[model samples]
Every structure is written in structure tokens, then in C-alpha cells.
Target: MSALRIEGYVIVSADGMLANAKHVMPDSLRFKGDQEFFNAALDRTGLIVHGRHSFEGQPNSPKRKRLILTSKTAALAADPSNPNAVLWNPAGATFDEACDCAGVRSGTVAIIGGPEVFAMFLDRYDTFWLSQAPHVRLPGGQPCLPGVPERSPQAILAAHGLKPGEPQILDASHDVSVTPWRRAG
Candidate 1:
């Protein structure tokens, strides 16, 4: 294990969903404040780890040093389209191996999401930046974590030993706020 600081970042609706049933994030969930916050945080990261859907959803993703989680590949393979990315299969290779492939030996590793990708790093996150669009609700939508429909997002984080800090309001007009959930000492 390298001295990697893993962090998770996500925004969810009132019902704790990341996207609609179609696995698409609707307009209601997109807030200027949240986008600004996410972008600023990502800029400070050394590496980005996410799934295919997340990769496609983010802007300027090809320019960043990242590992795209995928089961399609055997373990680790070069991403032909993006010179900065590598395809990683966690089952076939360790996180360290993926980092090596991406040449990210240390520093912060930002885990941006899509359910399965978010869930994979639950126990490993040093901090998880959870933003909320309290006014939005996605029924029968995709969860931010595996236990979401059955449990609240906060509860799941607490269960995984992460405690929520005081929330910072991102957009007061839209009632958007972000909380950093950190591992308990």
C-alpha cells in the first residue's frame, strides 16, 4: 500500500440517487455551485479513478491522468483513445498496479463515481465530498452507494467509519451544500 490518500466525490438528490433509472444525471441535479466545487477539488488531485459512465460525463476528462475501471479488459491496458488513461479491472489487478500503470505512485487519488465505482472505495476513502441537491429527487434511480435505497447516504458513510463534518453551502439560492465525510480517528 502506497501513501495514497483516496477521496470520493459525488452529488446526489434528496432521495440519495446519483442518476435516473436510465443511468443519466438529469438537469435538476446539476448546480453551478456543485460543478465549481467539484472542478476545484479535482484540480488538486494527483490521479482520478472512475468508471466509463463517469469518464464520459466529465468535461476535459481525456486530459487528466486517470484509470477507467472496466471489466472488459483482463487487468490493465492502455487506453487507445486517451493517452492519459488506462483501463483497469480491479478483480484482475490491485489498486497499486493500476496506480503504477497510470504512473501515480502517491498523493491524492480522487474517486469520482457511478454506483459500483463509488462502492468499491467505501472502506478506503480518507475523505468523501458529498454534495447534495436537496430540492431534487430521483425515484427508482441509481444510488451513490450500494446500500442507498435501503439506507441513507450518510448512514452508509457512518457505517464505513466516516463522519460528516460541518457542511459548507455551495449555492444558497439553490440550497446546495457539500459535506466532507472523513474517517474517524
Candidate 2:
């Protein structure tokens, strides 16, 4: 079987932070245009992967299939609150096996992340939709990818061999921009 086509979607601050020091996405970090962009991406995404923290307290559970990355569970099991979500332990199931279990075939798999989740798929992503809120800054916040010297989002993407495309200015007043990067040929 062919490998999965993984794509990642993330919103970082100009300083390269994904979340505040509290490790939570605050209201200050969210922009309407970014929300719309993510919603649109979700519409076409067949499967989604995200960290446990990213899935917690989500106002509403989406209907699409989702894999919540958690090491606490060894077996894949349904989330009690959201029927469409499942707890996934990557150590136990390979991506292919997880797809098989989810009854998903070849298609775009979007990963909404916490830093580690982003780091894990560094070399596996076919595309990464990176958004930035330049006006937003959270001092001592979580870097986009941890365990390495913090760097700009572009630098991180380029290091992983992903080339950035033209950026879309989502909200000029808010300084929100989104760039789509694909693996370089």
C-alpha cells in the first residue's frame, strides 16, 4: 500500500510560538480569518491527527474522523464524548494500521498539533499550511517545535525541505497570514 499523504495545519505567532506558556491557545491568538481557513481545510480533510491537549475542551466535536495522540492508551478506542474521535497510541499502531482501523484509504490526512506532534511528522508531511499572527506574542510560550533551538516558522519548514508558497494575508489589520508549503522537488 502507498504511504499516507500527511499535511499539517498550524498557527504560530511571529515569535514562533504555538501556544502561550500555559500551553493553551488563548483568545488573543485566534483570528477570524484563520478560523475560516481551518474550517475550510477541515471540510476536505478525510482524517485528522492531533495531540490530546489540542483536542481537549473543543467546543464542539466535528463529524469527521479524528485521531487524538495519547500515550496513555495502548489500544485504539472511541472517545466517549465524540464518537468520531479515537484515542491513538502511535507506539502501538503504525500510521497505515491506524488508517486501516479507521477504514480510511489514500487521501489527505491533516494534523493539527501540539509541538511534539508537529515535530514527529517533520519529514513525513507532503504539505504544511503555516499561519502566523504577527501581532500576537506570548512571552515564554511554547515554540512551534520544541527540543531544538527556537527558530522562525519558515526556517523550520525549510529545514524539513518544505518550500513556502506565496502567503495569503488573511487579516491585514490583525497581521494574520497563511502560507502553504510543500515538500521541495
Candidate 3:
């Protein structure tokens, strides 16, 4: 079977909200640790998948093969200059079908997200790379995985067969922890 991986940089408060929902990646929040984790995951991934909003938020680059998933037909367009980019409508096709069309075989397929995208592929993902920011609070922020009713992300991941592998404290000042999870066979 082909492998799917869920990976994202999340800034969570002590209360468990993932981010300010208004912004996917806020400039106000520092991500030095997340950057390092992303680099490592990128090294192993052959393709990346993301929601339309996340794709739009990214800096345009031709380096990686990317698939943007959306229900709306107009959410994405071909990048004439970058032939590696593909717009995938999940309504018309399954994520696996999209990956096959993109030529992502057994190698890692990184799912970078907005919550809906994460929720969509959580069951199929083989691994998870998460950045957990400790001791912060975003009272009105959006949850990392929405609609879960304040469950521990770690426990949820464990339930999905993902075991914690590598963990490092990124910043002593901010107490952000970068952790990697691998599927238990």
C-alpha cells in the first residue's frame, strides 16, 4: 500500500487551540523549531499535499511536487512556469488517485494543512510530524484538529497507530517541542 504522512507546524496555547484560525501561520508566532522539523520531513518526502488555503499561503516555488486539494473548481490553477504543481479536486477524485496522478509512489507524501485537510487524511496517514508550543494561550484561537472536543493530540495520534519517535525542545525561551511520530507497522 502507498504511504501517507500528516505533517504541520502548529502553535498551540496551554488550553489546546492550534492557532488563531484567522491566520494559518502568524508572523507574531516564531517557528524556528518548526522550520527545522519541516526541513527534515521535506528531505524524506517525494510529494506534498495541502489544502487550497495553505497552498495559497505558501511562497511560490518549483522545488517540490505539490498537490492542492479543494472542492471548488476555481480554487487552484496550473502554474505555467512550474509544471510540478497540480490542482486536485477531492470531490471528483480521491486523495490516493491524486497522488497516483502526481507520480507519488511508495515514498513519503506529506500532508500539510488547515484542520479540515488534516481531518480528511488522518486515518490514512502513516506518520505525523508535529510542533507543540507549550505554555502559551490563544483563547479565541482555532484548534489544531477541530471538532475533537479538547482531546490530547498525542493520545489521538497513538490511537491512529502513530508512536512518538524523535522529540526536541526547540526554544528554551518559548518551550516549543518538535516531535516526530512513526506508524507502528
Please give the CA lDDT of all the candidate structures. 0.91, 0.82, 0.66
- Can you give the TM-score per candidate against the true fold? 0.96, 0.91, 0.80
lDDT of 2 by residue, 61-113 (tens): 47788888888889677778777887888998887777777777877888888
Tell me the lDDT of candidate 2.
0.82
lDDT of 1 at 7: 95
Instruction: Name the best candidate (by lDDT).
Output: 1
Candidate 3, superposed: residue stretches over 4 Å from native: 3-11, 55-60, 74-82
* Better by lDDT, candidate 2 or 1: 1
Superposition error at 131 for model 1 (Å): 0.3
Which scores higher on TM-score, 2 or 3? 2
Q: Estimate, for each residue in 33-55, the C-alpha lDDT of model 3 and write its tens digit.
A: 66665666665677877776664
Each model's total of backbone clashes? 0, 0, 0
Instruction: Score residue 72 of candidate 2 by CA lDDT.
Output: 81
Q: For candidate 3, give the lDDT of residue 88.
A: 82
Candidate 2 — worst ten consecutive residues by lDDT sum? 55-64
Give the alpha carbon lDDT tens digit for every residue of 1-185 in model 1.
Answer: 65899999999999999999999988899999899898888888889999988853457555779999999999999989889999999999999999998999889999998889999889999999999999999999999999887999999999999999999999999899999999999
